[model samples]
Each structure stands twice: as structure tokens, then as C-alpha cells.
Target: MKTGGVLLQQKTKKNINITIRNLTISDITHQYCNWLNDKETNKYLESRFTEWNMQSLLDYYHQKNKSELMLAIIEDDTGTHVGNVKVSAIDKNHHRAEIGIIIGDKNLWGKGIATTAIGIVAEYCFDVLDIHKLTAGAYAENLASINAFISNGFIVEGQRKEHVLTPSGWSDVVLLGKIKSQE
Candidate 1:
């Protein structure tokens, strides 16, 4: 089902069209639920480790916590629900937050949509939310994810050795950070 959610913000490019918007109740579709369960699509995601139920998602949505901002990532031309970008784990005292993205549409992989999504969300985190810094982490093997953040002005800050277990073996976590410019 189409979210028909209000367009809170956007960032566009020739190969990528990102509509940053709030998620709606209608977004709880079978397609949305399936993405979380798709092993291949979620291989690099932390969510892949847990199971998601529709009712549980709905409950979480209704809880109305203000610590995070979750935005829907919609493909412009096809109006497909490709994924979501979120700025969560906010620390107001530190003026920082963490960001994450999940591009559920495997067909759109290798495209620049993920990078554009990060740019849009990071802009919001810095400009609108007044966050001084934004941080994210990716598995050592997830080059695409690392590139996306790097292209959006993030830099590798540190690495956590043997952070997560993968099929091959344990992998390090590449920590990334981007600070808002004083100017």
C-alpha cells in the first residue's frame, strides 16, 4: 500500500529521487513487512537478526517516542517504497544522533539512492534538529554502505574488531561520523 505520507523534505538527482517524509499508518503493508523478513535484502542489517510482527510494529509506531525521527524513502518515478532512513538514538545533551538506512528494494542496489537518502537525512539532523554531529556504522564487508556515508561527508572514526558475526566469520564494525560545520 502507498503511504501517502506528507512530504516533509526531499533531495533529488538524475539516478536517484529521494522523498524524505513521515511514515503513515498505511505504510504497514505486506510489502513493508516482507522486506524485514527478506534474508537477502536484510543481510547487512541489524534487523535481520530479529523477527518483526505487524502488530508489534504498529504498537511501536503508536507509542510516540520523540527520541528518533523515521522517514520514508520513496522512489519518485515508480512511487515504490524502496526503504527508510532514520536518525535515532538521539543524545540532545551531546547534540548528536545516529543514522541508518535500509534499501529494501534489491533491484535498486548499486544505484545512488542510498547515498542521496543519507544526505537528505543528515541535512535534517544537522539543520533542522540542530544536531552537532551524526554517526553511523557498517559491517566491514559492507562497502556500499561505507561508500554511501563517505559520499555524504562522513569519515571513518574508528573500528570495532570482531563486532558482528557473518556467514564467513566475525567482522569488524566501521564507525563513521560527520560533524556539522561551524560556518
Candidate 2:
């Protein structure tokens, strides 16, 4: 496909009426699934899920136990879905959570959209959500994601060897973390 899923989820100040709100229903279901399942895109992601289609998406949206949270990322000027940011396991008591970003739109890659999106979400995590610790695991082979996370105040915790696999083989996973205390 033409990465229509990415385009579908993008929500920025320029698109839609809710300028400051995150991408909601427009994203949760179909947006990332298409790119995430693609062989090329899956190369960088740690996990690849198989159970997805239009019907599966609809089913997933109705579930009450979903702990994961996602937000669509759009370019400031063009209003395009270059990627997305996510967080999960939001423990209000612990004020900790796992966070992630996925920039499958090659055309916008390396242009700082990922950085901007991450920065905004991290602010939301610490400032709005009052989360103390925000963390993520990246495929070690994906240096771009590592740099993006690290440059955004996230520090490397360690590397886990051969912890994940793509269609081809196993790859190491790197753990990164940041705390509101550090900021």
C-alpha cells in the first residue's frame, strides 16, 4: 500500500478542528497496522503482530482492557502523518510508563518530526500526566530510533542480546529510560 494508514492518523495544528488534541479514534485502529505489518517497516520494530484486518481493528477498538495509548504525529507545515508516539502501563501511583515512537513515513524521516513528536509527548508524560519515569525499548539495529530517544533526554539502561527477531533473524534490544526527576 501507499502508507495510507500513516496519512489517515496524522493530526496536527493544521489539520482537523482540535488543534491541541492528540489523534484519537482516527488512529487507534487502522493507521499503524498497515505500516507496522509491512515487511520493511517491521524490520525496525521489535514485535510484529499477525492478528489484524478491518474486522480485527474494529474488535480491538471496543476492548476495555487496552492499556496502550497512542497519538498521531503530523508535520507542522504539511499536516502529514510521518509517524506516531505511544505510551502504556501508565501507573498513576508509580508515575511511570513505557513510551515509544514509530516514524514509518520514509519521506519525512530524519527531518526531525520524530524528535518534535517525542518532545511533545514527553512533556505530556511528565507535565500533563505527571509521570515520573518514561521508558522504551528499541531494536538495537535501529540506530536512528536509539539516537532519537537518547537525544531527547533518555539514557541507555543496557542492551539485551538477541532479544527480538524479525522475519530474517534475531536482533538485540536496547533499553532506554528517562525520569521527570532528571529533567
Highest-lDDT candidate: 1
Please give, for residues 36-148, the per-residue lDDT of candidate 1 as tens digits: 88888777787677687798667765663344676788887777778888778788789888998888888888878888889877876777778899999999989999999
Q: List, in order, the clash count of every candidate structure.
A: 0, 0
Which portions of model 2 miss their true places by more than 4 Å?
A: 1-20, 28-32, 64-66
TM-scores for candidates 1 onward, in order: 0.88, 0.77
Give me candidate 2's TM-score against the actual structure. 0.77
How far out, in Å, is residue 89 in model 1? 0.9
* Residue-level lDDT for 49 in candidate 1: 77
Model 1 residue 49 CA deviation (Å) reads 1.8
Candidate 1: which stretches are off by over 4 Å?
Answer: 1-13, 63-66
